[model samples]
Target chain A: MSATDAEIYATRSFTETEVPMIELKGVSRRFAKKLDVAAKLARKLGADVKEEVVHAVDHVDLRVRKGEVVGLVGESGCGKSTLGRIVAGILPQSEGQVLWNGQDVATLPGEAARTAKLRRQMIFQDPYASLNPRMRVADIVGEAPQVHGLIKRGGFDEYVDEQMRRAGLDPAFKRRYPHQFSGGQRQRIGIARALAVQPEFIVCDEAVAALDVSIQAQILNLFMRLRRELDLTYLFISHDLGVVEHLSDRVVIMYLGRVVEEAPTERVFTAANHPYTRSLLDSVPRIGNRKRAFATVKGEIPSPLNPPSGCHFHPRCPLAFDRCKVEVPKLKAVDSLHRSACHLNDRA
Target chain B: MSAPTLEVRNLCTHFFTRAGVVKAVDDVSFTVDRGKVLGLVGESGSGKTVTGFSIMGLVDAPGRIVSGSILFQGKDLATLSEEEMRHLRGNRIAMIFQDPMMTLNPVLRIDTQMIETVLAHEKVSEDEARQRSRDALGMVGIPSPDERLKSYPHQFSGGMRQRVAIAIALLHRPELIVADEPTTALDVTIQGQILAEVQKLCATTGTAMIWITHDLSVVAGLADDIAVMYAGKVVEYGDVGEVLDKPLHPYTHGLIGSVPSRNKRGEPLRQIPGMTPSLLNLPEGCAFRARCPRAQADCVQRPELREWLPARLARCHHPHREEAAAA
Candidate 1:
């Protein structure tokens, strides 16, 4: 079968499942100005506010089913990291709700305490920055379990040893500091720390981007191995489409703080409906693939502070028309389980 | 064929330290034709950047061009005095750094930096220099070029700052420009735009360029010719398509195969084993022998970059052509 036909078949097979493990409904987060008490009182009394708010995470909707890895791909400062943070419940949403296993996360009493118990962990982009410089590998990996009270008294060392081994790290290296390890080794420690709490869901935010190509493969394979062994779910965020294609079961393409297209991995790769998605795929240089033409997208991404009035991608899109510039395109289904936010995809 | 625009012959750049000498660019040689782009691809510490620096006469104290000659337009730049080299630097040659901030001063406005650049090279009025600066900014696709000129470097975004730096380099219309990963930090869209602009400028003005980057994909699209650098030397040099399609050196083949895009999905990436050797303690004979998959006893003798084909060169005793043709 052709790649497109296989993609269609795969999309049709994905809708047999029910409700997702995690869902975000119209989630929007804006950062408020840091005002002093007197300034805050003045604003409360109807005084003029001078500071500007940053709309970091605009209205976004997404869902990740149980045991499925969802990849969120976008450039830096496109709100991929912000959305990931909101989904992980590390940051509070200014508007909208996050449903975790059919329950509103914000409504839960001591939400932080509850999420901590639920075992939703985030692996940061830079391993060097995420791992504490002064702390040894043993304490860095062991502290999560100690804080969550997962291990019994005097069993912390054994627990740390087990986690390190599970992450394919040498147990002896636990005594070494973060500075003593290479880029890949430090990332393994980061993974070991995340797994110590036995989290079912992980948010890997550009986990392997900072490492070399050889080291990247090692970490990616380690992640895959850990996932199968632990039955973990992942929300993988990265700018690299190649890495995402290798890891994700489903993929969401984001542009300027909003999702532009989302579908099963095969469908998105083979038959992307959105113009932006198609351009991005074409930009990736492939070896021994002479049939594919290079489609260089014109113009730079518009600044988020003053975005376009209608479709954010209309500025650089070659297929953009008057309708695209005036009306915001809502994401609609192009086929079963395949959705895109471009007006051209609006068959109706 | 016409003579190459810039011919680097046995160029060896070294850093003399208290411990020992660091052989950064050891006996590296290549040539670029007029209006052509030569991509120097390598991993960090491969000495690609140092080679570009050596050509521009930017090597600092304690680190100098210990031997060899850099012939630009038939003039040996290595033998020129500091004053003569300084005159040639911004006038006849230019360089774009990885970090735009390194090329730009945070305290100065865009117009001030660009106008000063023009006035330093030529006797021109401030208004004329400002006009030339505005044109340069517009050429690089910076919108509202005049308004952006009044703004400081800190005011521009990362990609925009890089565009401004590139624009500054283009003001003099130098015969050759050595760009050292200037677009590595930008997004793919911005990178594409910059590459297109650079290619257009080169084609229109008949200027030569050396684009030094580790990104093989960018080189595939932007470079006319490619030179794979390893252990402070060019292991292979040929047309971009020829080298990428049929790499002569084993190291070049491994480098191309290691990219994630080339491998099958879910398959383990093909990587060259072992880390880059220390420049201060390089092994004798072939620098890549430690990691080469096809290393043999004959590799113990150092191989020069001899012609494997017409206009193609490789420093490997066993080029891929013999094996493949024999098969």
Candidate 2:
């Protein structure tokens, strides 16, 4: 009933020995507020109006090898989705470099950049919001490929049908609009659209979080099946640790727009090194556990608009000491494949 | 034991729309003992919220409680007039909603809202009402209630705002509380904190609660009893531990099994096939027949909630025998 490590990893299309397919170095995205007319006038009057900058992602370093499923876990406004969008090139990072296939994607030549864009795709969280209500399933799924000249007009229907079949949708429903499909079916249409572009890597931002549990499972299975069949890699971003644990090869934990911890899924689940990661695991309600009580991590997630100095989590963390307030912890290796950012790790 | 605080018998609430009459809550029956929490677990459109609304007499014109006796402290809530029901509501029965804003006024300060709720229910002076509001906020783990009281609802975070809503609900010490997915919008830690506080309140004040949610694990932790609903009917009902450990109904079994945590990692989940039938046009027999694995031709007659074991009930044509379930 249980999968052995060898059995699980045997299905992996790529190994760690392979060079990273995508790498983010010092990736930081900042959003600056637009001042109102009054504020602009006040600033003109020498009131010393300081422009507020919301740091959505701060100096994050990440690597994803070919065919690896990296789960990004965090609470709301933790910059996980922003990070995902940055990877998929939908959003431009304010600073730092995004290297695709060890080459900087931004500096790539015109055609090369377009090629890179086609290789990496993003699947959004809400099926209803992302899909076009006016477009039929065929047009929605076939649009990208057709516009990009990947599929000829004559062969568009067949190509769309193939992508639909891969995504677990009946091709016969191609004529139906987004409104006609259920939540799961609409999500499949989204997936089919993404697959139509022939992507090698996908950044799924809370892909199944909106669906019911049963429908979620169906979608999760489809993702796994696609990964196996197409040798696809994913940067799967979700708030649900259970889903992340079920689907991820490695897990990355973020807090207030910073990478707090990174480890293989087993290591993160069994013995998390960071206090924030530990608390996130503790809060999940285990299905079969008879006793149901936990000391919840105190305090709400602080606003990302004005994140704390030094350690963002220190204010709410239980083991926070004086040193945690003044020093931003660098991610250091706790083990072979695990890295954690915490003041307590200094003792180790 | 003392009589159950709230007993609902054959409760059915239907929505009359231009399309057709939608039976949102169909012939549902359950009881919550004093100090006990009954978790009404179901997916969206399963009528768990309607059942809660029926108890609070909050179901609007389009929706009406057709037939059922909602016995609250030996009185029928279904028959109560709007005036009488309004008097009882927020006094002996309080309901919390999914969005804290549903219970909170966005423009008002926490203290003003809380004090008004208390004064409206009880004959209390302004100072005493304010003090009660402060105490209620403190009881739900909001820090510095006095300071929080002066702040507008917008100033509080999502978690804190929900706490304020919960505090207002508890100000009058209502005998029955119907919380409809109050913590669904919150983060896990915040949700755990609120659930812990609610559980403590029920234990300390002997308040009966009907906690309606789609999450089974949450129900397992918070509720003494659970009623798993499908297509407007409770397919299974029993003690939380007993029912979850050995769910008899196929729908309940499929639901529990579908949760990612229930399956070993890397393995496919034991998902129940097919989607829930539309509420407008449910199946002729058992509403769950379309998705139930054990469904047969004989499921045409809808099964009633009957005892499958001591203190346990399941509406199933083919419930798993104890031996069959063990394997």
Candidate 3:
């Protein structure tokens, strides 16, 4: 039942003429305020309840071509995960269009919707939290394919075994509970759960952030191997710039709720346009740049609820000018595929 | 060099669990010199944090230091009474945790906690203690120290709260500090600032430091010497540059090689195979044998930490030395 060597290392097929697998047009997600006990009491007493909103993702436009690995890099509260979820159809955007395979996923019919749901899956940051503790590894990975009717009623064990092997997990441990596995193994189990449904697109939201450095490498390798074997596309979201650079074909940098820069991996590293992007690259601790003075941004990330006027990065950007204060910088192409949102880039 | 600020030798700490004994830290040894930093680098469950706690005398029940010497100023801390350890701890020796909330009481104001920290160790007036607290905050780059001191822990940002904890640790001008992943929760920009301040403080005050973290990149710049821990053992130890640039042990080598910065974009990572062994039941011989590519039949017997090069030590039977490894 284990995956054959050929099956594990199957060559991925990509064509230049293929359309983007996922697209986000003017997407924004806003979460409403939750009332505390005091606030609830106040509302019961006829006191006005304030309406607070967290603009997690704002006016984002992204495209993921078939078999592409697009990295979405940002600090906490930058809406990287929210945007990823919106693309995966986990969260309905407050405003905008999420087109999957050139059609809006929201408008898909019953059969089409089920297929779309199975074709795209989400892999969370903490595998321990994502996996059900009560379920054995066998049920965790095998249940989805069965519910989706991808596997036969009696062929569950073989299908589960094959998925676990593809995810670098031993089929022998299928009977063990989620708690019985190590962090790396738990992550593999999560991946197996995702892969069992034969998904073509994955939204990996900090999937390797919780693992040890050595274990991080193992899981990252498995992810890369799976992409080739299954021809899967990924929207890899993480805060680690170096990791994003290592694993991605394109890198997109987000500040506040919007992407400040998007470019091919090499060009973004070599000749970055946005000041925020430059500082982010500089902030990373590299072995080659030993004892180099840290070029930290001036302040912490502003509250996404009341983000700054115009460019959200203008407050910390060293190159901020008068034009950056009143006018929001539009994403402009620096090269054919490289785009950056900055008033300075407009001047350049 | 003058006498080291702290020296740990043959340290073995274990936790008695229902399943079995967890050898959290076993026969680990290292030293931190005056005004220098020693980075204790490892992953979760690698015993890096336990080693710090053992030195600070902070390990709670179910965990005990079985045997070893934690020599601080030529004194064996392991043999010291709880009261004696207390006098040395927080006064001459301080520790910082990964979470700032672990050190700070959420209900207390910043000034009250810091003033108490200074007053607890020294015979100073309230005004003098407050002044010292302000100076400590300023030293760590907190803006408007007096104003910040008035606010509570919740009012300050995550990075600022950590800085406050560090300020309290520095109030007494402690000779040694053990910081366990203090910057792991902060953003990259904030992490940079904190690392700079800590490095500067060590230089100016002649305080030695043991920074425990899982991030190797942080150690590459911050530490004068590095100790790579694996399954509660000092698998490799030497100058940071020497150990990282030309690591002898396969584990250390693989760790550095796996980092994204080390690999070219789009190229498959040269990942070390297998996961870290469980502390409760590690593999026989070397705990890392299951993952190490160079493991041989010789590895069936445990290898002791030996000097592979001058001042550089490694615990491996077949280390990748520039010259042939001496048997």
Q: Which has the greatest DockQ?
A: 2
Winner on lDDT between 1 and 2 is 2
Each model's backbone clash number: 0, 0, 0
Interface RMSD, candidate 2? 1.9
lDDT of each: 0.84, 0.88, 0.88
Clashes by residue pair, model 3: none
lDDT of 3 at A166: 91
lDDT of 1 by residue, A259-322 (tens): 8999888788898989888888877655443322345688777777677878889988998989
Candidate 3: segments with Cα more than 4 A from true spot? A1-18, A34-50, B323-327
TM-score of each: 0.90, 0.97, 0.94
- Please write out the lDDT profile of model 3 over residues B11-104, one tens digit for every residue: 9999998988999999999989999999999988899999999999988879999999999999999999999998888889999899998789
Write one digit per residue (lDDT tens) for candidate 2, span A1-348: 125542354234335556688999999999889898999999999998887888999999998887778999999888999999999999999999999998999899999999999999988899999999999999999989998999975998899999999998999999999999999899999999999999999999999988888788889888887887898999999988888888888889999889999988888999899999998888876667653665588888889887778899999899999988899999887866789999897875
Task: Tell how far residue A218 is off in model 1, in angstroms.
Answer: 3.2
lDDT of 2 by residue, B153-177 (tens): 9898889989888888888888999
How accurately is candidate 2 docked according to DockQ?
Answer: 0.61
Where model 1 places Cα greater than 4 Å from the true spot, the runs are: A1-17, A35-50, A107-118, A149-162, A165-168, A285-295, B280-292, B296-306, B309-311, B317-327
The C-alpha RMSD in Å for every predicted model, in order, reads 3.6, 2.1, 3.9
